[model samples]
Target: METFDLSRLTDFDFEAVCKDLFEEELGVRLELFAAGADGGVDLRHLSSAGESLVVQCKHWHRSGRAKLIEHVENTEAAKVAKLKPQRYILATSASLTKGAKDKLFEILQPYVKTPSDIYGKEEIDALLRKRDHIVRRHLRLWLTSASVLNSLLAKNVVTRSQALAEEFDGTLRTYAVNPSYDRALELLESRHVCVIAGIPGIGKTTLSQVLSAHYMAMGYELVEISEDSDEANHLWNDELNQVYYYDDFLGQTTFDEKLAKNEDSRLLSLMKRVSRSPNKRFILTTREYILAQARQRYERLDRHSFDVHTCVIDLSDYTYQARASILYNHVYNSPLPQTVKQSFAEKRVYRPIIQHRNFNPRIIAVTLAESGLLSGHHESLSDDIVANLEDPYRIWDHIVRNQLGETDVKLLKLILTFMSDIRLDDLQELWMELGEPLRELRKALGVLDGTMLRSMHQYGAVHVGFHNPSVRDFLVNYVQSDIGEVTSLISMVRRFEQLETLWLIFPAPGGGPMAETYKRRRDQLEQVASMVFHAEPVNLRNSRHGKNYVRRAWLCLEMGLDLESEVIRELALEAASDADTILNASESTDLHAFFQTLARHKTSRGEEIMFDCISWAVEWIMGDLSDWNLIEEAEDFLRSIEHYDPGIEVSEALARLDSVRDDYAESAFEDWAQTHRDPVFSGSEMKEVIDHYKAIGSTDPFDMSEYDNVLQRLDEYDAGHETPFAAPRKDSAAGLAWNEVREVQSMMQTLRESSD
Candidate 1:
């Protein structure tokens, strides 16, 4: 028999489990009430005989059987006497002995009816084993089950799997099962691919993490794709059950360099492959706006209908109960003291947080996680939570301003210079380059680890990044508010990527506080343009990609700086002269940016230079038609040239592209077949497993028994179940108390009325 740790569920989650369990056990529908000030009734049912049945659930497994009995006799007995229901059923997660049940039975003689009406942990587990539907209904129950967690921890010894297991452990504790989970699961099951799209701090990544954990539990190996779809393509194994997760597959804040390398086509191709394979699953997450931007920018993405496999997580996905549960779970799992937890429960301090218009999962998590940094007073905590929810952009303001020291703040500002995660050594070098002490880097990293940043060991090197996208979001707003900080960042730039980041945050001056700030800092803007013009172009991969130089030239033009300045004129001339080099080394988007800059700047002999570059590009494409990327790039280049200058003749180039498309398709298939004929573990996989065990101070051989046990449990659970991906229960207020439900309903109604 399998036993779950009922302690994992909050009072409300436990009550929900009991409601579902008894509804099937007793063959009657039980109406669940919200928690709080309940009059000895958590659930009630009216029998055909006109009898009232009352059931109360106490999730006091951690409080011991003695405490449970004492509370029942001293507190609940009087309430039961007052109610005088025809039948009273007691459910507690505590494992009660026969003597304890009898004692409770004697305490409330007439109302208890019989001792069998009392259910304890043992009885609940037995019922759950019999009723698989109830087990699936309450996600927390099965997700946090001892069997599942142990299986996750013991089965996979690889470094990535172990680290992910630990993360899944923490996330499962605070994760709320919303409708989006079910929808995403359905899409992944039916289509084998799910793209989770939502706004920042909307739990898109969290939902994907939970779904990844689900597949992992079902004996699927987790393959985390960090940079692009090439990682997925290289790691794809037809013989192994694998689930791939790529978070923020698109550019985080803007469509910059991520989709520039023909990633749109590669991503779609991998999706097609995953969809065709029975043992493979793919999950990708991106902000909805960024995804829309990618679709608009990339013709391939725009042409493909992602809506069929997309799961959009929005506010509507989180009902009142879901929001409340999110709050409850975060608070429950936080490392705060008991006093702070009680303060949230007292006087309904959670009401404002639950009902706030800007309620967001990330904001809620951040607020509760950093609650220790706030004043200990209950009112302060309540007010701070409400304030953070009201304006999420300021969620990290308090931490950056009040909690973090100077070195810590400086580290975050420096990190903001990059588009994504930065190598620790690279960041350290950058830190030292900016005249900061090397010793302080470690100290600042420690101080900012959980609150503001996170560091992970990948590919044998430590990589540090913001804890979430919101941290970067907060820091961008932080620096944009002050011009001095902006200038300081520009002065510290050692590569073209950092300058690109600055341009993204502080775009061409238009209308807004940022634009006004740029206006006030015109001299600093000119200084940046000059710096980029002279600096050597470097991509994120630390290579001198030609697109970086092209990007720099275009960025200077967009800044509205002096085109006649010596530095600007020199940069334009260099770009125009080296147009062939730029075309050969850059992507279609980069080529487009380069040509547009040339057209806008109109360098000396610009038209002749442009025509020469276009001819060179056409001849280069005619030289090779072996790869799909080459074909697509050629087509995009021709189309862009046509769009840029309608008078340019490109019928020959167009014919060359159209004729060899089928030849490229046949060659691409042969290439894939040759490359993937024999699938084997890569060297990185072997090294990762060895290094992971070495780091954990373990070299023991793999434990096959544990793996077999996990498989057995999975088989047993799925024996008679319809599907693991069942639809969630519709009633959001299933386990909430009556008054709390009324409060949520009232708040929701007020919101509707206000909107009307």
Candidate 2:
């Protein structure tokens, strides 16, 4: 078929061809009119503001191939002609052939027509695909007309879609588990606000996002509203409220803590407004239990014949399908052993697929990609780049100190200090027991349970959470200088001991630990086999109290208490069972259990359980384990507690532990030295840090830095000349956030330096 040029047709048909091409791709429609009628230009285009290049196509396509050249030549001669329109496009259906393209370029070039390469081959083909299409020769003749091509440069036509790049990720799979997927699809197909709730890791949040994305793509308006961000306003102006995701909102707090009720009121009003509209729609995500408890204020979700629905998605059953899905997601994208996947798939050996707390798709992707677990998979695409997710500790630091204004930064330090898969009872008890510094700290941060608490053990419902391990590692390792602390307490203590060992390389600090004096301390430590690890926990005080007796048991266990395994296990059981000290006492129990189980089965009648037997025989002689007394002269009595007095003296105990601070990281010692060294920090920052600490664990405020390993890391890091101002977030309930105040501070610093 020969391509058409506008000149071959009557003005009416030429306008029709232009309209057809414009509407096909740009969704544009234009009107035909005489030259003099003007308003908003001759041709207009629709684009979401700031982006359209609207154009007015003119000239002709017809049997004027020869005369059209004469007209073009004549128009060039009248360079100053006033009759031309402001922006005229001489577009033609016949795409300029490679040969003709050169000739037109020369003839149009000398005249400064700014040749509008506006016509695409597809558009030309579309126009010429039908009957009465202007022939190719006529198309070229029309485009060459001097009246049209000359005035084309100033025009444009913009379309909305072209301006915005597709920012959505497409290759990944997103799924909502069954029964619920079935229910949700019904709700969506009919357009409903679905309220979903379940225990942590049951996939409520993921389902909300996926549903919202799916329906929104299907042309339903969807928004994600939350306490974390004001996404609710996104749907406010719409009369056609289609679907919405209000995530993690519980009823407003009765009191003003971190969030004021005013914002909640505003949100409530917005939700109501959306509901009142005949076309309003939404999906509410919150602890339904909490919502149900609230006295009815806003309309009940089921108020209508109800386009809305409510459902709880619990994963307790772990149906084979769900288990398989979870397993595939984990190992398919994880760095686990190949046999792990094989075992899971074969179903020959039942392997309990441990669900990582980070059940979101991104984390799953990261876990799989980083572990290179997809290596043997028969069908799996190579993983996308693994994003370095923000470290939860660092984000938490931003939250508590930067956002919340509770600068003591204790709650985070407490968590960082006392961690390792912990039981829920032990966690709560420690929060209640040793909460001297952390008590107020926890309340201030609003860790009020639920989202902040997580289950670490295979859900006997026993829980433990200290942020994701990766986030914690980031704070302690990647941004060490910024945090100036490792959240891991044991690690901090080891580092401190290391620093002290290094300092020991120098002559004992003046009169301190005179080579012989410190050596005696070393000898005393050596006398106890548990001290073999250099961190031997031996009770030096008289063993009078039950707690001290347990400590002695722990010491024996650590020292290869072969004979005393049963005794230690029995004793450690109470401590472990004592919700108050389990987190801080689990190591002893685990060590005790290991030996006790071994001794019970392996001890032949003639073979002696030396360590266990000795400890038990000794315990028999001491009628009361807590009956140890201390001599008045003992200044440092933590060790002597079991042998002498078990009670810890407030200041004196701190002073001795203060001395031990030298054994930690040099940075810690330096932070302590410089902090106390600065008369003010000792009076304030140090006081606050410790007070917050004591609130979390029941230790003295001053003793906070002593007890929390992370605090020591932060201190050492601070003393090491790292940025001490930033700390971990105290609460993970809200997504960690940071904004301009600090950025501007940094900016000013830069500006000031530039001025200098």
Candidate 3:
């Protein structure tokens, strides 16, 4: 008999768990009321005999038995008398003795009927033991069970899964189990693969963590793949039950070099293998936009139709109740003083936060964790929360500018130069090249770890990267706003990849805001072009190769730099005339870009060189249309040179590529038919799970009427507003900027005096 620490649940969570537990124990459907002014009725049921039965829940475990009796006698007895129900039942998380039940019965008279009608902590735990489904339904209860936590602690000792298990252990306390968790679990259970895709800060990674934890609790070995699918493949064990997690599998911001190294094909292969294996499970997460980009760029990935196994976590998945629970859990578990927590209970300070349009789980967590950072802002804690929610970017802005030291900021800027994680040794080398002391770099990394940056050890090397994509997004916005910052980044460039980062930031002339910023700073922009022209070219695999000159020429042209200049044109011609240099390049985008730059230049020699390169590319592509890479490269080359009247040979190659693609598509369909099957939990069992969920009613623990009213207004506002995601206006009471510092300090002093 496993007993849960019911103390882990919030007052509202406790109410919900009790509702489910009693529904099973009593075999009667109960209607739950809103949080406030329930008229001494937390739940009610009308018997077939027309008897009214009311149940009151008091989660006073911390208040002790004496306090519980006093509250029921002084406050609740009068309210119960007014209702005058035929039967009364009292439920509490507190452990009540027989004497206390008698005292309650004596207070309520005939309405109480019997002392057994009162369910205390002991009775509730016994009910939970008999009704296990109810316990499982409320994820907060089972996930925090002592057994599960102990399992997580034990698993944390394994090197392969230590980081992720530790992360899950820390986050499980505040995690609100929304519908996404169940959906992801079903997909992984059925298909053995689930790709979680969503916008940044939408709980994609968090959902993956929860799913991983679930499998871990079920006696599955956890393998976290940090870099690529090769790690998953290398660690594959058929005799063991294992769950593999690959966070941001595709790329964090852009198509990382890993994908360029043909990892997409390998990843697709691993997905196919996992789909056919019952003992293996794979979970991958990527930003929705990044996944979209990968599908468009990698033909094999697009053809595989990852959408079939993808569980996209969107804002719609979070209902009002779910949002409230998320916010409540964070606040309840935070280290805030008792007074500050009490302030949240006054006048429903949570109402505006629950209804905020930018209500993201990440934003909510950060606001609570970093609330102390806003002490200097001289606003109430509620105001600070709403302000941060209004503009999500501002959450990191103040932290970066005000709190970070000079060394920390520089280190962050250095990390920003790479699209994905940088090797610790490589980052240190770059740090030294930038004239920073090695000791300062270590200190900076230590300061930023677990806050703005994270370091992971894997594959015999330590890799450091941003803690989340939002940090990188913030740094990009930060640097683009300042011309000095942009020029400094260009001046500090040590690798061609860093230059590629700058090119992505200040893309061609039409790129939205950053392009405009670059256009305004033409001198700095020209310096970026000059740096690319003079810098040593490095290949995609991080090695020196002659083909890099072609990449450099292509990059300069894409930056809208004039390749027609005598010196620049000479370099372009020199790279283009070497047919071997163009033919050896792996990426078709690189080749297309180089030739496009040559054709745009339009010199007699450049045109002749471009024609030779296209002819050679067509021949190479025609030799092998079996692989999607070659077929895609052929299609891309033909499209790039179409304006130049690419001759009949190019048309012939495209026709052949089309035939190959059709065959591949048909073969892929056949493969899918052979592998895909109905979900393991489909039919009766799944319906039972869903029906049970619906019976539990709305999970919202707040005032139901108020929550519904606010949701209706939000819908109405969305209909008329151009930007539906805009933050709503706070109520007058919530908008007031009370002195939070004084309140916190005063509360601390009072607590100290009470202790004395």
Candidate 4:
């Protein structure tokens, strides 16, 4: 008979095994109590034929014989005496000596029918062998076949899976296992091909690994993606049940059609084969957008081919409970002190974390990890989480500013401009541009090997890019400073110039946007607005730099940075004449200051540039006709521009702005009065509202029927349905929002009755 390894059983599993063993071996049905709180009795056999017995189990596989005897005597004895059953029995997984058994009998003499009733490791092992099915049922977790282990080893899946599992082992212990895991298992069991799709970092890959580990532990052969496609073809001869895992199999974050044709087709072929073969399962993960792109570009990889077999779970489906549990897992397992961990586990602490806009598993893990590093910052930790949540670049900003060496920082900046398509040779050239020796360049590249830059096989050769898209995103937005006469902004601008050289140096090939080179070019332009706005103002004395500033100024305006864009606009105009004026300008430059410089223009070219600056400013200000001050500001700039070269375009545009501003102001007030029916406007405020329309050379031309609802509400108030001085919206539940409605109705009535 084979001996059982009771040490391999979890505490819960041990209790379960005991329940089954007693029912099967003794032919006595047993009742189990709640697991951890099972006070003393784990199994109860209640029947007239069996004299009502209570069995207590000690799953102390690691305890010494002396400790086991002590527990049986003191704890088990007291509980058995309290229960006062007709017979008492103690069961334990501990291997006991003769002296220990004698001591336990002496301790429990009064409680049990006999000391022989106590069953130790030998008896339990005998029961396990007599009922072999019981052992198999309870100890299945340890029953993996040697062939499955060999298969995992052959594919090198053992090492990689172990590393990934350990990375999350601590956190997974606390993770309230998501229901989707079971749902995924069921789908894969029936269909054999499960595609777990979601946004990046939303647990697709994590879920895949979890399922992979689960099925692998269930004695399935593990087949993984290989560099050689021939290995997938060899899997056709497999006889055992197989589980194949291909993470990011379709593509990384987004799909590239060329890569789909060259590489992903092999995986697709393997999946098709798996669908037809018995006892085979295929599990893959991809970003939702990437999957969509793949389906569109590669017809052979059509999702319709495996329609019912696919399962998609996304962030949108995560409930508050699920999100909170995910956060709790990381926070509980974080390396923070015990007290800190307890505080973080509090409902109040994690409540905000779940409700936060950036609440996701990836962010939760990163935030908790970063929080541990930022000691004594509990008060501001939530705020910091919010800031970094809004802009994930902040996390990267923290890393780059604090972690990277000087050479690494320079290399990172150059690589950011290159985006993901950064070539080794180009990196060498860009690194050399810093005037560093060839040896120093090689040393810098060596340092970046595993941290940020990674090797990617594409375009028929190996190339280097960011390890992931997030790293590139962070590095591109991040700016580091050094103590120097020049601002870091000017240095960043020079970097952009270097990026321009890359385009001429290596023109991108024609393809879709997902292509690496195309993405790099796209990211360069995409980051320009943020880069310019984030950088400090540079003295634009040179005409070329002035043009550059002017270009960015317009781009900022287009980006809805109205106030900042205008500030840069005026600075660029001043820098055209004297760059010192830009450095001299105060933070709060008024509308008069904006036009004052235009009056001092000497040459027509200078006047033209200044006029163009004023024109752009007025256009932006007048774009939104609601700002009363912008109309007055445009009037002032128009008056100043007349002294230089005020043409029909300027005069007509200014006249149009004046007309629109007056009309917009009157209409805006009317709309405000209608929306805000509050009766809080003082007598002077009402008179001011009337006089304001008159000053704009227009009467209150709005129709009074729009106030019908407010009038009806006022009638309700006057009819004593509500008090005149009732609290705001006191009758709201009664369907009368009297405060604002009454107020607006009174104002409109007073305006019509009162003469202007």
Candidate 5:
């Protein structure tokens, strides 16, 4: 008897296997964590759907489900028994014995409300999808097993190459979110280990995305080095078939162990391959920190595989072209909003809050966006970039030189935390909460709120969200060495204010709270509310070029554009068709307003709002959906996504299974056959047998061929007859529908009982 060993598997291969398989069959995805199996469950799926099934893969050499019954008690012990999935599916690569099955069934029988034969699958499915889905996806990702003992040794690691190639090609579609040009030539020609570093929110990722698209356009066979998967390892050993991407390598660290392997590490291996291959091109994107790790080498084929290279493009100051792009990319390209359009033409001297720093299109875009000064925002050559930009190096050096005290660090945290747009009044309470010295708080606060932080701060107070999206990431990483005692203090403040929203404010879902606040704050508000009198959109619907701005306005609001609730929501709905599916609702400032706009669009556009409806359904599945109507629409939208996946037929079957035969199922099945492919019958011979059974009304059919065979079943149609299982009554809607032969069993059972 050998023991099972799953620890031999890597996270990536196991998770991918589970994601594609378990979710397909069970609608549950599992996530596997590296450490700490709670109780006996090594994998988990967090779900709201009340039904959960604790699955135990019985790896027993020879087993009984009666022995498996021990795991059932585990689910109950964990207090998840009630929400337990309908079937305690004892899935195994092993077989079960009849005696063991009987014992397990006996144990579960006491808890069973009705015979398993009579149960409606609806309750089970709802719980699986609605409540247990997240947990399932998570668990599958974590615990899906591969048979290592029988695993084949690779003659050539072809699968990794293929998967990587697929992943690389797949990123081309993502270019819709971020665009690039001639990326292959750029990477291939770069002379040194080119560094492309930008401040946070500076669109470095965009540059990488664009570069991928460029290589694809130039006939380069693209290979995506999956962050850390066995498949990726195999990819390195097999082929340097094409250009490879080390894109976002630093973004996730969990895969670092796999990446560290020498030959197994795809990036290092690809580097060697390309250095040797003729005219080879390789593209890499990393934050400067990761970039620092390499020898900053140039010219390869070091059995080192480097190719024709040029100097890395160090794009400085939002070049006029970049500023123009900021203006153009974010503004209305369609039916433009007039009021929003006019403001961009106003020639105000563009002074960067973080002046004189190297600027990217995003910083300029975000600043103009956050300030709600889109149209009036202007650029000037005379504007001093060097003077205005806070030299982060200099500021940190100064603080370090002064032996920056506790107050200085605490004040720095508060300032950075609230750099977006909170009031001085808000800061006062935060100040006391942290218990920092007042003078120190005030002094650092001034610098942070001042030009010292540059474009970092909007108008002193934080933008007011879960955290400062832009700088919070910066502070967490960089402040570890400098700005002493900062992150620990910031973490404490964050505990006091779990979310960055106002403590007193609690807006209800729809409209009441916001409308009330509108009246109360209409007069006294200082930041954005003050600007209500003259709201100018970054995008306008009027001019030829500005027509796009109106559409752009909606996108801006979606991507953290600060705007009045009504304006942003309306804009979002107006151009919702073009919005990215990945656009999150949490990013929206006023969710209700966005929903209201959705409601209005639903009312006005009806079926034309397909894309928005699809977006809503995806959001719905993620548990972010609120409206009941949204759920209804999601059912319809599922039909739409159905068109995209081959599995739609199965989903439709599942949907049909949801109903007890009613006019809906009849109509649904009609529509399904009319609109999509139909389900498969058992077999030609079984089908013929079923037809014969149908021909002789109230006649007995032969016992089903096999235990798993449906035709072999002999459940009684009515209770008067005794059988192994009860026959299904016509679902409340669909009348009893067992074949006529099943009815004969009922009559026979009745006759036998009467004679007794």
Candidate 6:
């Protein structure tokens, strides 16, 4: 007889299983009460309409049919008679005969109206089959075959890409608690297509692999789609009750390619078939920009590929907690020395990793991997962390520098100058244009190896690009050891008149940290801009002008150089649609001056254009408006634009920020400050504070300098009392003495400060 083998579950496990089965299968949420003090009711089910249910789980698996009935009658019936629940359930592990179930109901009389309430072993088996996922999750020894997943994929001629499954088994097994996992699981249950999308190295592929493992554990068959056109088609033959896994279904290899691939239409057709079949799930992963570009370029593929029901698991949805979990998972599981691991538990050690905007899973993984090779000193660890956060590309640069040759380096620089993935045939032409012979070109590619350069077939043409976007960034700014020769070669293929060429090389738009490597070369960027501006004086109004205009504006904005009238005025036009360019060009200190420039342009250009410009600028700059200093800056900038536009959104977002300025417990901030040895509020906490304030109504809080000083002093006090993980400060005795004097002076200062 096929059975659930009820002996495998303990009394507590039986109660918990009953809770899951009732909640998931019956759609009734049953609350499992305390084990010993459940008042004869192990599970309580309350219904809003009226009748509530009280359930008892008797794990009498060892008792046969006659013994189960006797056990229930002697103990359970007496307990239930006292309580008198509206709907009573006797859920037991032991199999009961039909006559025994009828007799139990009769013993209960009116309390148990139906014999169905007295569940037996046969009924438990049916419920187990319906909610088997719950059972599979609880019992490790439950028979869910990994081979069942393997057998789903049909044999075909197209070769499979490297799975990286074995390489990343540890990461997947210990996957952090991200909210997206539940969302992904829920979507996969109902929707046919669930696309996991994110920026490069942000764990999109890893997430897809983890989800595949999850489905495999759930007894769903797994089928991997091949990159080859015919092979991808050959593998999808109405495989029911399966999870079809496709990684990088939309290629990230080339930006210039119009179509994702001719093969994608067929893949979409397969997805359509999956959608129609209720039992199948189709999950894929792709970079965000690649998917965006594909939607823009291919109408048929997009139209058939997605619906209102399609689920997209995007990395942008990751909150600070989720990001912290990613960092924590990697650091906690790493084979670092015990002392280093202990230090990581300190707030100061992990806080920076959580706070960095460039904080990425790949960067964290690589940095920690390299940490294992180094001596576990605090100085070395701190330096490594700071270096990776500041210049993540340096990690890739280290790998490339040790692996590649001189010819390979030259070829990479040449590719970096192009700024886009080049077709392999077109690359050969560019090499010939550089006066390099065909044989030398082949030699250069051979020396470059697959680690640094990746070759992929998109459509029918072969495309070559850097293996990672960070690698491309590294090559562009710092890999200029042979710059003079490379510059000469670039000048031959393209004229200096196209300043957009230089503009395209800078990865980030607003002179962000990514562009810091090139900021020192501001003079070079300026010279190119001047040459282009002089050569094509009348070309300012054309579409080509936007790229060069933004680039010149960035140099002026970052370097504090005087902006030309034409560039500033035209940039305002762009800012009406692209406010990010203006915000990115200026750092936090320069925001007032940057906004003043925009206000001047808004005054010249009429209210409609300027209002849109101010709207976008406000949206961009107000990201940190919760800070007291930034609020003051925002006030000044808003006054500059007040004559031309009202700036309602900007004012509302700011007004909302001012309401809860002192909302947090200063003592907690002081505690964290003392541990971190830094007075500044962390970026993560600042974001939370901003979000909290923004969600509430505005308030007219006291405009007191002492309020700000209170925050600063708390930091100072914390710093004065340094503990472990904090770099020690010398003058603790003096600080303690000053602290007493400051407390007395604070009352008088607060009155004066408030009056001022």
Which candidate would rank higher by lDDT, 3 or 5? 3
Backbone clash numbers for all candidates listed:
6, 74, 0, 2, 76, 0
Off by over 4 Å in 2: 1-176, 188-191, 228-235, 239-242, 251-259, 262-272, 275-280, 292-308, 316-318, 334-343, 348-351, 354-411, 414-756
Residues 578-669 of candidate 2 have per-residue lDDT tens digits of: 33332232222222322333243343421233233323322222222121111111211222222322133333444644343323223333
The most accurate candidate by TM-score is 1
Candidate 3: the clashing residue pairs are none
Q: Which lDDT tens digits does candidate 4 get at residues 383-445?
A: 556566676777667666676577766666555544235456545654565576778757766
476-516, model 1: which lDDT tens digit per residue?
87777777887777777776678667767655423545666
- The TM-score of predicted model 5 comes to 0.27
Per-model lDDT: 0.69, 0.35, 0.68, 0.51, 0.34, 0.53
Worst 10 residues of 3 by lDDT: 732-741
Candidate 5: RMSD to truth: 32.1
Clashing pairs in 6: none
Q: Write down the worst ten-residue block by lDDT for model 6.
A: 747-756
lDDT of 5 by residue, 375-395 (tens): 232332113222213432332
User: Over the full model, what C-alpha lDDT does candidate 1 score relative to the true structure?
Assistant: 0.69
Assess candidate 1 and give its TM-score to the true structure. Answer: 0.80
**Candidate 1 vs candidate 3: which has greater lDDT?**
1
Worst 10 residues of 5 by lDDT: 732-741
Q: Could you estimate the TM-score for every candidate?
A: 0.80, 0.27, 0.70, 0.47, 0.27, 0.41
Model 6 segments more than 4 A misplaced:
1-163, 168-171, 226-230, 239-241, 258-261, 301-321, 332-335, 372-379, 397-469, 476-756
Model 2 TM: 0.27
Q: How many backbone clashes does candidate 1 have?
A: 6
Ranking by lDDT: 1, 3, 6, 4, 2, 5
**Residue 133 C-alpha lDDT in model 1:** 55
